[model samples]
Target chain A: MKKIIQFIVLAFVLLPGVARAQEAAGSINDMWSFPVVYAYDEEVTWFFDLSTTTFAAESDVYLWIWSPSEPDAGNWENSSEFAKLTYEGDMIWSFTLTPTEYFNMTPEDIAASAGFWFRLKDLTGSLQSEVHSMAYTDYSSFAGSGELWRSYPSSPLIDEGVSILFNANLAEGFEDATSIHFHSGLNFWDIAVEYQSWIPEVVEKTQLKNMGGGIYKMDLIPQEYYEAPDGYVMENIAFLFVKDDWAGTTADQVLYAGEFIPPPPPVFTFFPQQISKKDFLGIIRTNNEPGINTLIYTVTAGTVEVTGEITGGVSEIKGFVNLVSALQNVDVTEIHVLVKDNTDRTISDTTIPLKQLD
Target chain B: MRSKIIYGLAIMGLIAVGCNDPDDGSYVDPVTIYEKMDGDWGLMSLNMVDEYAKANAIEPSEQNMGAYFNYEDFKIRFSVDDNMEPTTYEVMGDVPPLFPANGYWKLSSAFQQPNGEAVKIYLYSDAQKTQMTDELKLVAVPGSGEQMELQLVRKSGGIAFVSYSFKLNAVN
Candidate 1:
């Protein structure tokens, strides 16, 4: 029979890639009426995730697209469009066009006339609901995947060169001038607030119940990227803290919350650094996730440190004590830390002047 | 011989339709599974506590903002058939709040383990119950055990709720 339907579509195109990355979603519960299309002002608002599509006169839903279009090739049903709005029963059966008013009512001389589609509708009675799929705006919440943040406030404690300000929320990120650099193992830097670093020198975009959200990088202050270990409270929660979601995500899905408490030991940072060379030889790794076999270090000059190690044997934290041999000479001044984590649990801190930066 | 006596009466009607037995021996009568689970889980949930945050707060809550997402196309149809059991929730969205309209709630899901595995799944609340004057609290699974999980609170005018957490995935 057609070679058994081409061997079941060639075994689903030869399977594996984790089931083609399973998840285009289905059954998002229902009751949505979204309809906002301002498109820089063609005007039309209408949103409703809180209720309005209990659709019982024909049910099916869609109209999900956040930009990019042209896919279904041979233009059937307007060839895969996005930006549509229609319903049945209990109202809004259809009307709110505005892709410049539905392509000026008949393909108004075609030239990208706004669209975002999702409409199947088919109810009329018995209630039967089930049609969902939207909310994938090209992924990238730090590269797709969710929920893994857990809170950890052991009674407000994180020592070492104190300046500890990392209150979360950096919604819908990335704007060509990106920022958020804090890593471990190989030390790193970059987190300022009044001195603007996660690049929020000013960016504002608002729209709530309409989705496609964003808030852009806010409040980073990892003591401008690592060098802590003296009594560990780093300038108490540094200011300008607004990008509240990079790790724990909660712009209020009923106030979810979690993810932030990492910088609490013989500190260090990693990753984010696109340019910084007045003097850089970075890599100061310290992981005390619950290790405290007691380790210490000291350093301070105009900033140049190398050779530090705690290499992580199954990593509950192990060794690392070189601020480049505690900063060569007398011009070196401040950098001191003392850890002891295999339950010995000691803790110390210090760090603020690489010639007083930020 | 007469078609083997009608195939021996169709193999005794397929052995009485395969003898029906899913763990046989049962005495089910926990008041009909606690009245069909607190009576349909009190019309799905959320109705009170108004405020109570510091008993050493681990995540204790109650701040509903107008429980949106239910417009049964906006209906009131009540001349008096919600059995009049509201104790305090007032907004009158075209008028329909009196008696617990948003003030108190008390859920009770009886437990009974022995490997039957049930952590408070009782449900049934076509909205009407008594025996609670105040002090409202009822975590359920007979009272918190069976890997406990079910929390809902909010009554004193936090609007009513717009979005709380049952999280069916915003982007799993």
Candidate 2:
């Protein structure tokens, strides 16, 4: 008698569900929500109205939310449950998307889209609704709305070991910007040549000082690649601003430090522009260059070539170069001088006019 | 027609060659040593021959030289007239020379030598120019064309020669 009573109750409870599962067929008519203007990590509820044919009014419903990036049912990014409906007046099935649910989305996805698309299904998983997308225009406005407060120095002319100032102001979703990094190398022309294969040659972390109001200032001293062998020639450097808390990043772009200039072109002035047959003093004045230990110069005129070295300082080299043998043969001669720094960098090339004095 | 084309090419080559002027914007006016050296000069300092002997480190003897030359009480003046003739006046202790201490000087970029070519400034004691007091090799320090230094080299044959240096400033 006890088993019969339990079977009757069970059959009665499941009989209606079985019948409803076979007969009940309805399409999700529309999904409606309100109060689109909300801050990040704010929870909101969505209402779904279903047009039923033969389903009971007290059936259970489930809500499935998805990121627009991957909207397939197998890969439904997220899901939420709607409370049981007890009120008989309005057959409105509603789902509450908690703040934790919204925060679970990836930063990249939240930055890209205002709201996610969702689908509705019953507990049996037999009947499903079509996929629909919704966006909170007010809330979505804050997504991906990051912009640079001030323009970086456009092609600033800088020297090696000089302090370069960098300032940026972030607003909206970029409020958490904690650090700024400067990525250099891969010049303007190299980017085109390497195409997508370009990577930063050097990355330097700049120290930042907060000036409130989302404004950050830093003095970046680029030690690496400052004295590059080829030297900097108006090459473009990229600065990346990152919010480490959420792993948010600003797109990489060129700072255009104007041009990386090398020491002034090797220049020299020679005394006695007019050298007589008797050996006269010639002072070759070379501009001081960094790391220059010796100045190797070649004096070439007509067919005579004499190579000499200045060991002490590159600033000035004074001595009597034995040009008597070289110039005694010609009436009026032109002496070509080629000078190079210790690094074998050509500093200057000039010619001196000499005449045999009577 | 072929000859006409050849003539056109020849004319173009000649035009290109004529446009190649290496002396463009490189003209430097050459100033002779006589022009730059014609100024009033005063001796500033002197490098004593050997201070080691004055320190009482060496024994007293006549061979120990006290000093080579002293110019504290004497100021020499050089004058170059428009005729290019040079004259000198030696003043001793605010008193002018009693006998018109006149001398002649010459500046030349070359004096025939085997190896080194140097600017030689010759100072003769008389108008007839029989005696010479000094023959200095003037080398303008690199970068400062206005200043000239004459190294007070010693009389030793070897490495002791190039030790002393004297500076001459242009006061005029």
Candidate 3:
């Protein structure tokens, strides 16, 4: 009886240890909190969801904050050693730590500390989630050397094929900048103004031209990048400028592409291609779109031009021109109708052969 | 015995401090002006008659007076939260086909009614909200707190470009 009892006790202890040592199936799903890009003074409480797989009591989890120097290393600062995550409701583990607390630096040190990253790991430190980078920006740090402003294309609308003369004054530290990259994304305005997390596609970086003093300029022809079909209006195009470690992304500039649209052809009916001198020539016509300021109707009978203006938007406009006097001496005449808009765009249709009526 | 009594009181004080709940029962949701204007607002009808038309000796007709102003087959909706981006615009009309109405809207705190009776809301055509497409005066309908009207005015250099009076009925 004593031997059987010892075997049962040993089995209970060994089985649990083997099961706990086994690798867990799933990983951490998501880590979230308010104010992703934290200010120096703000205290952030991050809640990590571990609902995917529950571990045995013997198993453990950890958090690692990657330092700026150790870019390639998996294990950097073991945040779990200092701050242990307390159990929160709904299988979420909570840890309260500030940027200043983690880095041992205050908000005033953000200019030197640009790139920072963090991640969560298991006890063995083998299983982990993707690293989350921190993008720290402060008004003072952003305008470190001096303030910058953009001139030209004051409004967001720009004509296609025309080079936008983009001119700006660089800050003090940015004078040594070698290149400026252009980054763009569609529908940036639709992203939440406060927590805009969408990443923009970076276009190729090019060297900047120093145009005397502290002024810099770039003549960017948009058509080269955006293939806007004829009469097409591209919308929600967000663009920004970035330089090498000198300046952060400048304020976003959103623009609309306004290409020229040609006017549509006018529709009209001038029946009876052949007309008689005594018969009145009735010309009727209309345009698909409005804005017809004036319409001129003309008839030519070999070196003789007779014309009259027709006004208004009508599907059927019947007007009779008395060629009885003009064609009285002629045998035949050709009829023409011209339509025009306020912008000086014109379209016309012609009818031929007006034999003198017996 | 006296030292033990004093130690007991000190431990009890620490316990009381630790037991205090950070979240009090008193929590009120704030009702901001933007929340009131957030929803799907259908445009039933629109008319934009320019002051220049009257000066140009033009007749006051829908066709002649505002010939350039075309507001047909279009619907606009405002989002409630901070994610109210112009890209998420629910444009219900032919406007998006030709002139993409990636509408964005925001309330201008700078301009308010002198009497403080109304708020000014700025509307934009693109997602960036950089271009000022229209300016609207949002006011609650008389006697109806839930119902409202948006009066939009387009002007330039003291000349009336277009005046749009919209009766927005909430669909959502």
TM-score of each: 0.18, 0.29, 0.24
lDDT of 2: 0.48
Q: Ten residues in a row with the worst lDDT in model 3 chain A?
A: A191-200
Native interface contacts retained, candidate 3: 0.00
**Better by TM-score, candidate 3 or 1:** 3
Cα lDDT of model 3 by residue, A1-358, tens digit: 9999999999998996566543333656666543333345666666677776553323455556655433224443333355456667677776676767666665567446645565555645555556665444332322234545432333333232222223344533454556555455434533212212232232232333344454444433343444433333345456665565436556677654443254456665543233444334445455434444455666666777777765656343434455545555564555444534334565455556544221
At residue A67, what lDDT does model 3 achieve? 52
Sorting all predicted structures by TM-score, with the top scorer first, yields: 2, 3, 1
In model 2, which residue pairs have backbone atoms overlapping below 3 Å? A155-A256, A155-A257, A155-A258, A156-A257, A156-A258, A266-A347, A279-B117
Error of 3 at A12 (Å): 99
lDDT of 3 at A149: 42
| Residue A248 C-alpha lDDT in model 1 | 20
Q: Candidate 2 docking category? A: incorrect
Model 1, DockQ value?
Answer: 0.01
The CAPRI quality class of candidate 1 comes to incorrect
Model 1 misplaced regions, further than 4 Å: A1-130, A133-310, A313-315, A319-358, B1-172
Best candidate per lDDT, number? 3
- Residues A1-358, candidate 2, lDDT per residue (tens digit)? 9999999999999987677643234565655542223333445555666654233455766655555333224532222233222223256666555434444655455656645665555554565566666544332322234635333233444332222233344434465456544333435434321111123322223334444455554443233433443333445555555453325556665666554555465455443333433333243545555455576788877777878776645454433355544555555456787877677888678877554322
- Residue B96 displacement (Å), model 1: 83
